[model samples]
Target: MTDFAVSYFGGRVSLRFAKGVPFAIAALVIAVIVVGITSLLAGSYDLAVWDIPALLSGQGDKTALTVLWDLRMPRFVAACLVGGLLAVSGALLQGATRNPLADPSLVGVSQGASFAVVSLIVLWPNVSIWARPIAAFAGGVCAAMLIQWLSAGKRGENSLRFILVGIGVAAIISAGTSALLTYGQINRASSALGWMAGSVHTASWGPCAVLAICAALCLPALIWVVRPLTALRFGSELAIGFGLPVGRAKFGVITLAVAMAAFAVAAAGPIGFVGLLAPQMAQRLTRAGVGAHLILSALGGAVLVSAADLLGRTIAAPIQFPAGLVSAVVGVPIFVLLILKRANSSQL
Candidate 1:
């Protein structure tokens, strides 16, 4: 009713309102509506977006319901689920690692899955589609395990030195992947490039099922580890000071983070930045403080991934880049801002 309040309300939406909870919820609701409409309307054979609700509820025509049930719906669910996982995994990894730069990709999970998948695709040209996800999943697990073993020091003491080891492994695997592509195998390279770029636009429900299963299995495990994760924020000495199981807890969280990251990459093909951006974006949203609130970060991640997918499909029209590419492009600016914030002040 006041002139100042009216002016403030009319001028712009406040993104920082009360840890931005209201806006985040609004953003999520809007994202869901947008994604649902876009998925129903997208592709060469477009359908009326408004008709989707009837189709989903089995009240529509056979053809419309079939299209929604068989193809568009799967792609829609896959995009949101994988996106949510990638983003939340990023948030979890960063919280546990206590490094802004730490991500599944930075820790070697993406490269591991990428290397395994590309190698299998290139070598076993006879392999079936059903086998690819399995191979990628196996590769991801192997990568996480390798990093854990190499990073473990005497008595399992934790240090940034483990990150250094993971970085080295990532670099080595990355170079090897490059070599596979550089051997004048254009078709193999193209496929590998596509996988590395990451997309859920063409995803079938099978890969989504793999990711969803991981979420079902790993999320509760992550929750169980949450208390120790909070303890970790105060540093190992402080954690030990509070009668927490310092070495074991940190190692467990770290392992869970790696597994989640690896499984995500297998499901969606080495998607990056979601892990880094999701938590940072959520932090800006929460402004309440640092650390993971799993469900909120998941929603934020899902929103981000779906928005990026919509942009990827719509912005270029007939040609679309990977959703992962869009996340990287969007995330770079966020990382820069975080760096600048850290330089100017030490709060993050």
Candidate 2:
């Protein structure tokens, strides 16, 4: 489809999107809304679909209101926020690194955040849950810095080196996290395990607000990176030849990505594969500019996570599965298919 550009702010800001992008984005938005409504209505504590209007209007049974507002609503919101953040993060990483397989978990952001949050849980159980995002952000930043330092040298940045170093760092951090889980107190470790499993069942309005605030704060950064991402995709040398500050742009993109992933992990634990899969899904759905691609990826991620959470809670009735587990189960086969597709393309 052809592209259309819209100018705003006296032409200082413009967004270009493919003709099909709007349709794809609308579809994803509808999917998210449907998943969210279904999540709110279907659960162990039944809430009739027809009563949703009354309940939302504040005229429902007290118990139903409590279940809807306090439990289901927050969980659904959290899933959307977390999924959107992670998907955007993954899109950024893939663009910045010029690696189709790059994602938060693959590149050490999730593991770093997990390490910090798990340490807090296992070592200082009395700390407020609100502190998690801060710790996670710090850990993720450190990890990103480490990867950058290790990957850059006399020849400048190397995408392959970056991915390799990040994989090694992620593995080390994951090992540390496992050790903490293994040696820590059983009760605290169990609590940490539940969070690490990536279940949003315990999500409340507090964490939901935090995730929303983080997403809002990242909005400008997202817009700023669109051009850089598009340029970077053509290769670092070409980006530099085009008068872009390749190093600064790459650093900024990676930092933005890390922050997004860290916030999501802090709020809902590390939900796997959403970041990895969403961008690919978006790309396959429509050929669009980076801005529209990111929008599609975020919406796709929200749908994936919200659906995963819905299925987790409803599929087995009272026996709930963690959304992470379900997403992995669904994502792994898709991931394998992506790998095979890439391999076949390279061969051709």
Candidate 3:
């Protein structure tokens, strides 16, 4: 049991872990390593597994080093970060909204980011690439606020009402994206479309670092909000009675969720279903509370996206599928299964 123990907040708090968690986390780590190696070795130019150690040590074949370090590594790292961020974002949103179906992709956050990125790309072609993330973040905030307003959060939380509003917001944003694509120049349209499909094909160290830094900065805030979130789960009245700042905590959690989603969208466009899938999978695998759920969700997200990206690249050889397409392909069935399970459990 001690072996499975994990600490949070500089050991000020201790949360017990399940007996199987260590094994599960270890398995996930191994899976990530395997995927990273596969990504490094199985690209357009294949390299021997033995060569990887040499490449890291600066003694491998020049071509192998170039392929591994410059091209594949950034993408591998980016995919991991994007997946983790998206999953954690989903966890936060699910907690904040008290809705299992709440996810960035479903609730208009990703669509809003997509719309913002496309609008800037088309309407303000002269804007710098660095500005896209900011715009996407702003768009995500707007989307969240719109959802809250439409759902009338001032009255109280209603899962069904919130989800319906999110769907409406997503539809409006999607329509705007389509209109931009419909009338924009062919060249710009194609580029936006590819980005929106969630390709990590052009991954580079700069964007990868950006994603890492953003996660690093947001993590402390997440930790701070976790306890409050757990309290909020009992209801705002109980949360307030417990001395939790319900409104501030809700804002913090939602803002963190939106920011994480925006970062993922900025890095790899709107990779569908990772945000939706990760937290749900994490929840199913563990009975631990919010903190553990968040960590596990991040790990699960990393695995799902990395595996999806690797499969996308290898399944069709020279012709590649975007991770988003793969996630959507895989996620639809999982989504249906979740819905059915929820319904059945409720019936019981």
Whole-model lDDT values for every prediction: 0.70, 0.89, 0.86
Q: State which candidate has the highest lDDT.
A: 2
Where does candidate 2 stray beyond 4 Å? 9-12, 149-165, 340-348
Which has the better lDDT: candidate 1, or candidate 3?
Answer: 3
Please identify model 1 stretches exceeding 4 Å from their true place: 1-30, 125-169, 184-188, 287-292, 340-348
Q: Against the true structure, what is each candidate's TM-score?
A: 0.79, 0.93, 0.92
Model 1 weakest 10-residue run by lDDT: 1-10
RMSD of 3: 2.7
Clashes of 2: 0
lDDT, candidate 3, 1-348, per-residue tens = 333576889998787767666666677788889988888888779798988888988786788778888899999999999999999999899898787878899889999988999998888888998898899999999999999888875556777667678889999999999999989998888888888889787899999989999999898998887798799789888889999888889998999999999989988999888878988877777566677778888998999998999999999999899999999999889877765665654421
| Tens digit of per-residue lDDT, candidate 1, span 135-219 | 7556665776787788777755343555567679889988988888777368977877777788886677777787788788986
